[model samples]
Target: MTFRQKNKITVLGHDIKAGENCELSFGVANLHTSSSVDVPVIIERSKKPGPVVLFTAGIHGDEVNGVEIIRQIIAKGINKPKAGTIICIPIINVFGFINLNREFPDGRDLNRVFPGTKNGSLASRVAYKLVNEVIPDVDFIMDFHTGGAGRFNAPQIRIAKNNPKLDKLADVFGSPFVLYSKNIKKSFRNTCHKLDIPILLFEGGKSFHIDDQVTNTAVNGAKRVLNHLGMLSTRFKISKPKKMPVYILDSRWQRASFSGMFKPSIAINSKVTKGDVIGNITDPYGKFNHFVKASNSGYIINVNESPIVYQGDALFHITTKLK
Candidate 1:
């Protein structure tokens, strides 16, 4: 794979200077329609060398807020890193990003296909490219995401519980809450951790739409990481790192029993008690109303926002309640 070196104008130390950022091609593929596609990376290498931290978004493609956040960071003339490199892949699943869809054109979830195979499915091939050409080079990795279509997730961090370093990194972002997650099946975080590479998951916003608050929060967090890694000289007054954030070892999705308009009584991040009325499923024809209640007491980490739902569709994602 060949890479081209380009000098990009960066605002560092209150002045604009041209710096080298890498444009490396990951892998190429031929679409069934006879067109070719290439996955490339944008790496900002500082004049002084320090730890390399990779910040990626669009792992799910539909997660737009993170993508916007990355874009803003690269474009905004704010504090610049003094040492090491910052690789920003604002759009990972390019095909999905183009189509404004969550899954790849091959109908696979890119997040669940990690450390992929050289010769495998589309998702696997891309995952392999990331793990080999990208992951191995970074000292730390931050993957950004947002709630999928039909759901809303508050700005939060998700870190693997075993890595104290990664856990500390999560709190530096100053989000309202953090979740201690385990190695999910075939997840990118799982693959990165297996290689002892610390990774943090920051999820916010909603798919196909940009939320200003989430974007700002993510931009601030990325800058803080740059500061934390010594890539930048400016001091970010990160709020004191929070105690190990509450953990949700397990979560379950509550699905709708019947299709109708969903009037949610609870908001994302709200705490609910067992049997609390969370929402009401009602008919637009004004004949039927079904109440939805919490089966267990916990934090409402996620809620459906699609307004309408189908039978058996997931409606709520409840994290274990904090005592």
Candidate 2:
């Protein structure tokens, strides 16, 4: 297959070529009197054609792990895909990322605004454009993500639908855990699936920080997915990921119950038994303390990092049983 130079497609003011890979900044808007915003996309093309895979991150903005993972992959270089193209969008919500926030300037969760309207809110327009222009060009997508700020998550792949093909892809990701979930109402992955595009969501570590272990797992898992798709050669193989017992947990927020300083006993991935004291929430006066207990036996998949808490603030996210 010979590579030819195709004409350029301009997004906002940046150029993306059809045959060759390029980076382009799309859309421009003002949130305030002085500043404007633009989304960055890196499109890489193989000399030979193959399945085009889109690697996107920062949809929730504060999820730094996914952003970094995408950055590292492009910087390192991907092997030639056997058929199409590869599009990598490291940070889709620049406004939220800059503020270290999970939502947009309007306080809307960008992840929920999928297949958005062209003339709607800033987030909606971005989603609409992404679904219309970018995603339609890909055969598959692998979206990267992490827990929001003040929360932690185990490195895992989320299979939202029951496609055996996708399940096999998730297994090939080689993570210690794979979360079987159904498509959430309006998530980007769900929207893509509606378009007959198979998209896998890879969640690892926590928001706003980078963990080398989690990053490595994400990269290796994505590489395996590419290999499984025949986008890349299968010369490099990874051991089957350890199977952690799968749980369809009825997860709920364990709030502080009162405004106080939280002293947490468990960290992410800590196993706890039912009735175990997970943390202590104390008032300013050394006088009163309330114990935070586990209602069920499970591993602490997410824990609050901040000590200062308000009533109704989420403290822990547990996934019961380990495989």
* lDDT (CA) per prediction: 0.75, 0.75
Instruction: List runs of model 1 lying over 4 Å from the truth.
Output: 1-19, 30-40, 77-79, 233-250
How well does each candidate superpose onto the true structure, as a TM-score?
0.84, 0.83
The sequence of per-residue lDDT tens digits that candidate 2 reaches over residues 1-323 is 12223344343344555457666776647668766666767776655556667899989888999999998777767533443567788888888888888899878888898878999988898888888777655677889999776676777778764587677777677776667777876789789878888878888888879999889888888777777666654445544555633533245456678889988898666778889999999988899899999977876767887879889888887765333
- Lowest-scoring 10 consecutive residues by lDDT in candidate 1? 8-17
